[model samples]
Target chain A: GELARAQPVSTPEVEAFLDTLKWDKNGLVVAIAQNVDTGAILMQGFANRDAISATIASRRATFFSRSRSQLWTKGETSHNFIHVQDISIDCDRDSIVYLGQPDGPTCHTGAETCYYTSVPMDEPKLLASTLYALEELIARRKTEEIAPGAKPSWTRRLQQDPKLLCSKIREEASELCQTVEASEGMERTVSEMADLLYHSMVLLSVQNVKLEEVTTELRKRFGQSGIEEKSKRPPKPTAG
Target chain B: GELARAQPVSTPEVEAFLDTLKWDKNGLVVAIAQNVDTGAILMQGFANRDAISATIASRRATFFSRSRSQLWTKGETSHNFIHVQDISIDCDRDSIVYLGQPDGPTCHTGAETCYYTSVPMDEPKLLASTLYALEELIARRKTEEIAPGAKPSWTRRLQQDPKLLCSKIREEASELCQTVEASEGMERTVSEMADLLYHSMVLLSVQNVKLEEVTTELRKRFGQSGIEEKSKRPPKPTAG
Candidate 1:
């Protein structure tokens, strides 16, 4: 039960640990909050000694706002708290990480994380979680209302016209297959595949399905070949 | 052809853009480098005016080393240069992002990115690119020579015993399927899936197969159903 609680802030051990930290000239250290379950970095900010102490005492992630020049606990306003489970300092002791469980979306923009924005490049790029990003964008588009006399975006048009969306999906998928059958170059193959993925994601969003559900289904099939083999084997004897 | 070259650094346009940046008290701003192709963040550091100018002029990602009190281009020593394609500033104008193509692994430790380590947690966790990380770890283990009398790791044992590895993969896959058949909770399903993914990754490493190859194959299958429908359609009229 004690392990479930935050480490006592008044302890001598914590005091010594804090003493070892190498704070910058402004008496602040870079602090990163990582989702304990997903291993995604939710956000990064600066923290002072008081902020760190407040985090430990309250079991909530707290940061020192540079402009405000004061400590503010995350989710104090949004109620999307990152519940700190543990705090760790980097090897160099100049930076810290708060391993925590977020109650809701951590970003102010309502994206999963603040680091979603990628540096602009000319070539098409795929983020590690591009599918997830696409899903989020599509979901946002689905919920957004169009104003009077406003033109509907391509995504909005797809969301409104179910038949058109379905046809587009089929069209993109067929194109993707043609790329493979024609022995098209890697770039064409990737481009077609991306189109298929995008259209498929939009369809999923229309159906109120999450991308995670699809990934989970794929994960299930990863072990499908072994199921038959497992069934053929004699069941292991269980002890009473 | 013009798109291949970096924007001229001496232009008044570049000067005006730089003027809008909100540098910190020390005349430094946060800089992040992202892989142009993969969309992975390579690393982050602080940059001064000189560092930004040097980066734009040289078409390389450069940062100000606070400890060294000088500007240094990434991969200057390692030769794994991040060739800048473009630079972008955040909406706040307080941070900069360099979109670049890296020559090799960006991290000094040989991992693809510096953001590999997830903050420690008691429960199991999975990163967005856990498979890639596992592949990298397995590859490292494959190459590293064991010190005299040092005990071999579990991964080393798997690498040494091909049959054992195969059996383990099958076993994990069966267990994963069992989680589904037995109506196990979501946690169990996710855990088993993670196990299967890990073992599969290890197998891929042993066989010299990359995870990207597997994903590409899956991408091909995303269009498989449409191939049949496309085959039934009449040929398009040839254009004059």
Candidate 2:
């Protein structure tokens, strides 16, 4: 999920950016391509300055194919084009990363990413934690203003009206409770809870509160007396 | 994201189910563990009758360790237990699948799933296609009478009150439109649209409309003139 900050740079700026990279003897740099929206590692390839230039110029991810011994414009044959969003380089400058939005699957095998194959849990933390993936996106959007054009995300907009967010949470929670208490609609309960989870994440995002904090509190109560744990909490203040 | 239907199975049933499995000469069967909630494959291991018995008895996934030459209760060392929900045998009965909810990461290497490494184009059809997953789940819930105990899904309940669902959709759509028109909040528009998407999915589910059908219609209009496409569709009935 790690990538570089992207900003539009001109021809000379692009050239200057490339000059900063420490290329290998093959005149290629290991490139990691990550999905722009989902924050998933879509694929990885190698790139030379020429390929980078073509990629920047064409706004498609272009790579120098080591096997083919030439510039390979991705999607040239597959048409699964990776529209380049930003290009970033590692601190060492030996490796480069391309952040892009793919029109289709990135893996030639039809997978979303090149590294879709689990490699003995080489990087377990990076596994697509599907349900909360959107939550993280919203969190990032709230914090980093990652989306270009100064676009405000839904998380940002909801932060403007905490009352609206809270009301939605309460409504969704009540609905979820009703569904569950009725026990006559498991799927509905799940669906209702999903809505609640989304709204709850929005609240957490707005408050800049991490999920792990709640998880930590939960963990603390794992073997302790619930009443004892609750006894230590700060007293609830009257509503302002 | 394939898994078994996880309903709390019983002892004799578990025994009968295990009996149906065709074990290897070493009395082993490959057991694949899957997350019941997200439908993500968690891990795979071998299990013998004892392991299965222990798993069923303890309500935790237990596996046979070939190298260790003994029964290995998952999360024994790591505390990342897979709380067994259901066990299903393959059609061939040579393999057993354990659908469970993990207390933590499933893979010893710290991954959510052992098969997290995706193989190249191994399964091309499932490269996300995100929007309709909920629709399919809702559809399944609506038709199959899933989640034993004869639960009428919230989708079903909402369908009974079509006007309520319609109003929710209309409210969400209007809010989404207002957010976009106001242009002061991009995130609000996204959140609003999310609400609309959820409501729309509910409508589709109740009507038993598959997302692919809608997609097919959209695809048909890809290159056609919008005005022409609109004209070709059946005329709308007059509003009541």
lDDT of 2 at B57: 67
**Worst-scoring 10-residue span by lDDT in model 2 chain A:** A118-127
TM-score of each: 0.55, 0.33
Candidate 2 versus truth, CA RMSD in Å, comes to 21.6
lDDT of each: 0.60, 0.54
Report the Cα lDDT for residue B143, model 1: 77
Model 2, span A152-215: residue lDDT tens: 4445555666656555654654464455335435446445545555556566566555443432
Off by over 4 Å in 1: A1-13, A34-42, A53-60, A83-92, A97-101, A115-240, B1-8, B34-42, B53-59, B83-91, B97-203, B206-240
DockQ of each: 0.11, 0.03
Cα error, residue A14 of model 2, in Å, equals: 2.5
CAPRI tier for the interface of model 2: incorrect
Model 2 lDDT per residue over B1-240, tens place:
012212233477557766876787799876656554454445556788888777766767888877779778778777778876555553345555555568888766676555333212111212222343344445554555546665454555555565566556545544544553355364454454455555566665554444434322322222132313332344333121
Model 1 C-alpha lDDT per residue in residues A40-122, reported as the tens digit of each score: 55677888887887777777888888888877777877788888766765444666667667888888888766656544343
